[model samples]
Target: MKKQVVISMLGTQLDQGFGSARWEHWRPTVALGMHEDFLLDRLDLLVDERRYAKLARGVSEDLAQVSPDTQVRRHDTYLPDPWDFEGVYATLHDFLRGYEFLPDEEDYYVHITTGTHVAQICWFLLTESRIFPGRLLQTSPPRKKDESVAGSYAIIDLDLSRYDRIAQRFQQQQLEDRNLLKSGIATRNAAFNRMIEQIEVVATRSKAPMLLMGPTGAGKSQLARRIFELKKLKHQLPGRFVEVNCATLRGDGAMSTLFGHTRGAYTGATSDRAGLLRSAHHGLLFLDEIGELGLDEQAMLLRALEEKRFLPVGGDKEVDSDFQLIAGTNRDLHDAVGAGRFREDLLARLNLWTYRLPGLAERREDIEPNLEFELERWSREQHQRVTFNREARRAFLDFATSTQARWNGNFRDLGASVMRMATLATAGRIQVDQVDDEIGRLQRQWRDVEPPSVLDDLLGGDVAQLDRFDRVQLEEVVRVCMRSTSLSQAGRELFAVSRQQRATTNDADRLRKYLARFGLDWEAMKAARTTSGNS
Candidate 1:
């Protein structure tokens, strides 16, 4: 068992006793030793005045008489003003700092009943900060005059983990916050769910600008709005959420729209404009497609983000609008910077908390949940319930997760597919025919956007010498080679079906020979594509 120790201030008025009658009257320090349940092993008393030394000794003697096992020690602390919070705190801090603490062998308690309110507060702070390293011990006097002077005591432990209800409440709050960040979608992608959890914590704790990078229609804009809503729900931001597609802002109009403009600032300026930044004061500003911003606009945006103040277009004075920024981009800003199209300083500022959302095809496991969400949303909007038949649902899911279903537009494409099928459903039931039709439409859409042909550059118009069959086959083979990292990987994908039929197959050799028919090699094809890209 650890030794019990109590540190308390000497109450000059409350602890006074005279000769034989001292035992009859009640004293707080003496009563501390009177209780059998709180048998103190040691008592350290704090005294401020030389005049109180005699009373301190008397109290010590009384405590010794009540509890013979208790050892009394006196600490003389000088305090001219008992009510001076700073002085009292400094004195107590120095006293606790000088004392050697053995927490493993001893349990310490700081008594808050005897000192002035300031000293009591100081002791609480010291103990709570673990400088004194103890729990708080508060003592109350007897309620009735006829009651014993021992009164009652309570010990307060500051470690919150010891309390079940409070800890569970905090845990539940964090869960709700993460759910709110995800818009309660119940998404099934493990990596995506973990990323959302991290974002929830950061969104609540920080006001730094976040950069969301992904392909178009990958939910960057919707995620930004959800972040704004979460912060607003927590009362972190008071103003409205202002959003703008930076791709739509161009030339001088971009400046006027983002940083405000004065009347007669430019030829098209008709009246004073507050701009999106000013409107987002004390709130959140989401700039979607931020990579599309010009170099000059990027410079101005960097200044606004850094100083929270910027000069509007043709304005003399700078305006202030403190807002959190969340920037979204489908393009890589690093490439843009190398191309001299984006400002390095601005990209550095926005990259503090960057998140890359995966495209829908990358997280195909979440497709079913998102599909349900889209259907529910459509029902709410159209005021008509729509669901897929058993066979139709299975068919759509099979195709949706298949390698052939290219979700190039991410969630937007998935939502559109769901919408089309729901609209075409008869009597709120989507049949197999409806799903099949939607699948065909999606396949056609993706096929139409396939990479353009590179045969003209590769062949150099060989005087229009080849048949259509050879031309089509060679074009596809070159496209596959260009997309692949190596000859073997490209051959594996191209001969996926044909190679399976052969017991012994060298796909790389087969691919090399096939390319040689068009007078092409793997390295030359890759080089051609690289040259085309750089040019």
Candidate 2:
């Protein structure tokens, strides 16, 4: 007879507070193997709790009736903290050093049922580390009531050879979905059209050091990822896209974290670790908040860009890192350079392929599409289907068009507003009444007086006075000139000077000088005076 396949049944009763008893009655079940003929091995059900052990023992007795030789061992041990890939790898290394578990070539399968996301990531790491035997099997909880009680389960079979491909496809799908969701604000505005075009270009091009400049919340990072996807779809490149915020990489840590470090490179350098650049080799590296990178880091980055090589911290050997670099920043890099804060050479390299995303106010046409998109997202998040009523829609359009809400925070601000409205209108329909309070609140928060105009500044004497003319004369001249036609006409019509009669040489010269000062001629003065008089 074939050797009995060992199967483990792991179950956990989630604490549902007052509802725990009811939920516990419907325990989840798992089934394993290709034929699904394998029964739970009774010897594996080991428990320490007296009452629980008695209950488990009773269950084992029933299981034994079906499969007498199957071992049932249950230990009252706390489930391992959801496997952490990095932590597990470190632990496995230690275990190996201590010769705790000997490696074997035989096929072994470990079935996990309780932990969710953590379990998945841990399993992925284990497969990646090549520590697990055969492929890890993940079983889905049984569906039907009787089936669940009878131990029905969905199984996900992992093939090690296809792991990387599957992971890549999964990541791509997720990224595509995210982009579609975020860019849903359907805008056909010229500015938005240009942005889309630029994104497409970036996606198709394998050129490095792309720079994305825009105000905060303008979707810089989203655009970058979209470009990455486009490239992947077009087969322009093959590799994972990694994003790192320069703002988070501070001081020496930033350099080491980015360029990698050899063991004993620094005080805490315990292992020869691969940095993000090395990890992202043959992939895309997105540097967000590039402006926050310190001067030293900037110099190092510039050198790397120029030489295509960088020395890891405390390592003399230069490592070659050839990855497409995409950077984003809200600051004016030119200003940063002027202030001696940013490296001019680095900026020049990044400036080669630069894209500036316009803020929402500049692309008002996209607001409605974005709103609809947000509504969809909010509905999905709240687990409620909802729609905006005619009045609410009208109110939103009116507010969007009429109010000069700076929207300084751009798409992010709009998204937040949509989320708030969706939350308040979770009754399946959004109404004007439901959104009115929020509108009022936003109105108050967004209210801002426009900055005084240049004309106002001129009137307030903030402007420098011309040494040639007295203020009163200049004021009168400006007033009369604005109210009349050309200087000649204004002088003749308003000052009652006859154009036919030859005026004094001094007066004519003065008129010519005045015209020259304002970058006007006698003909322009005449036309202006005529137009002013008619008006």
Query: For this target, which candidate reaches the highest lDDT against the unseen true structure?
Result: 1
Assess the local accuracy of residue 86 in candidate 2 as a C-alpha lDDT between 0 and 100: 63
Clashes of 2: 24
lDDT of 1 by residue, 1-535 (tens): 9999999999878888788987777778888888868879999999865868888887888888889999998998889899999999998999988998999999999888898899888887887677888899887778887887788889999777789999999999988988877777888899999899889989999999999999999999999999999999999999989999999998889999999999999897888999999999999999999999887888889999999999999899999999999999999899899889898889889999999999998899989988999999999999999999999999999999976788999999999999999999999999999999999999999989866458767777671697867886887888888878899999999999999899998899999998888787887888887987898
Which stretches of candidate 2 lie above 4 Å from their native place? Answer: 1-185, 447-535
Report backbone clashes per prediction.
0, 24
Model 1 reaches what TM-score against the true structure? 0.75
* Leading candidate by TM-score: 1
Report model 2's TM-score to 2 decimal places: 0.51
Off by over 4 Å in 1: 7-36, 43-98, 111-133, 138-152, 158-165, 453-535
What tens-digit string does per-residue lDDT give for candidate 2 at 1-535?
A: 2333332334434211123243223333212322236543323332335435555555555445445666655545333443565654454344324432323422334455543455446555665565553344445544665553334444445664567987888768655544552464446677667556555545555466889899888889988787776667767658889999998998779989888899999899999877888777777889999999999888888887778798898899999877888999999999899989999989999998888888888778778887788788888987888899998898877787553466767888788888777777756888998678767766666655345422233345532444424544655655555555445545654445444565553444566676466454555545555665676
